[model samples]
Target: MKKKVGLYFGTFNPIHSGHLIIANYMVEFSELTEVWMVVTPHNPFKKKSSLLDNHHRLEMVYKACEDYPNLKPSDIEFGLPQPNYTVNTLIQLEEKYPELEFALIMGEDNLKSFHKWKNYKVILERYSIFVYPRISKGLIENEFLTHAKITRVPAPIIEMSSTFIRKAVKEGKNIKPMLPEKVWKYLDEMNFYK
Candidate 1:
């Protein structure tokens, strides 16, 4: 059987526990053999100023996933062009690891806007999508609700956000509970987001 890997792409400004919970759930409860937390170099929708350097974010992801053998930290998008699109990243991953079957791991909130994404149709046609639930306002398109490739995994609804974490850290709040121990230590040591 082909090794099935779910690609969970995120900025991971400082890898937090919520991210782990979702990834852990996907790997443990779903058909995915492993989950790769793909650290994005840049997200077109988010401002660049708030983002930490690529390596710092990657290091945090590495620290966050080190104890979990089934979870991995990936910096594949780092070498790709700036403002990289998911479709492009998927294509690159396929080229690099031809033997592995790649799937997408995302939240239901993102599904609402999946249609607006660049080459989203191509992603749907070529790859499977594993969607975890989110507490968000928007309605998911009916097409996605019945889509063949999209599978709704009943993972825990984690209502955490990197922006909130950053804000708390900057305000000198003890946000340690929101992050992995190793990640919190790294962020504290580096004095980031302050």
Candidate 2:
């Protein structure tokens, strides 16, 4: 049987415990053999200035996921282009690694606004999507639902977000428990978001 891999893409400005919890849940709940945290250099919809440097963000992710053997940090989009689009990245990954089956893992909040993505229809047709609940309202719906192989996983209700973390750091507050110890140390050492 082919190895089932989940491509969990995110900015991961500074990976937190919430992301890890969802990732662990996805692995246990789904057929995924492994989950790759594809660190996106830029998200077309989000503002650039709000995010930390790509390398810095990637480093933080590496530290956060260091203990998980199944979790990996992929820099595939680092050299691709600015304002990375999911469709384009998927195309490249598929062409390069045909032996592995890839699934798109995202939170429900992203699903609510997924239609705005470029060539989103093509994406749904090409790969399966594993949706985890976010702080968003309502269920997943729309034209793409019928075409895509979709699975909804109920993640732990930890409303921790990177935005909230950044705010706390800016205010000189401690972020214990909200983030991994190693990640927090790295962030503190590097003085990120300060």
lDDT of each: 0.94, 0.83
Task: In angstroms, give how far residue 189 of model 2 lies from its true place.
Answer: 0.8
Top candidate when judged by TM-score against the true structure: 1
Q: Candidates' TM-scores?
A: 0.98, 0.93
Report the backbone clash tally of model 2: 0
Give per-residue CA lDDT, model 1, range 42-146, as digits (tens): 899988899899999999999999999999999999999888999999999999999999999999999999999999999999999999999999889999999
Please give, for residues 148-173, the per-residue lDDT of candidate 2 as tens digits: 37777776766888999998999999
**What lDDT is reached at residue 183 by model 2?**
90
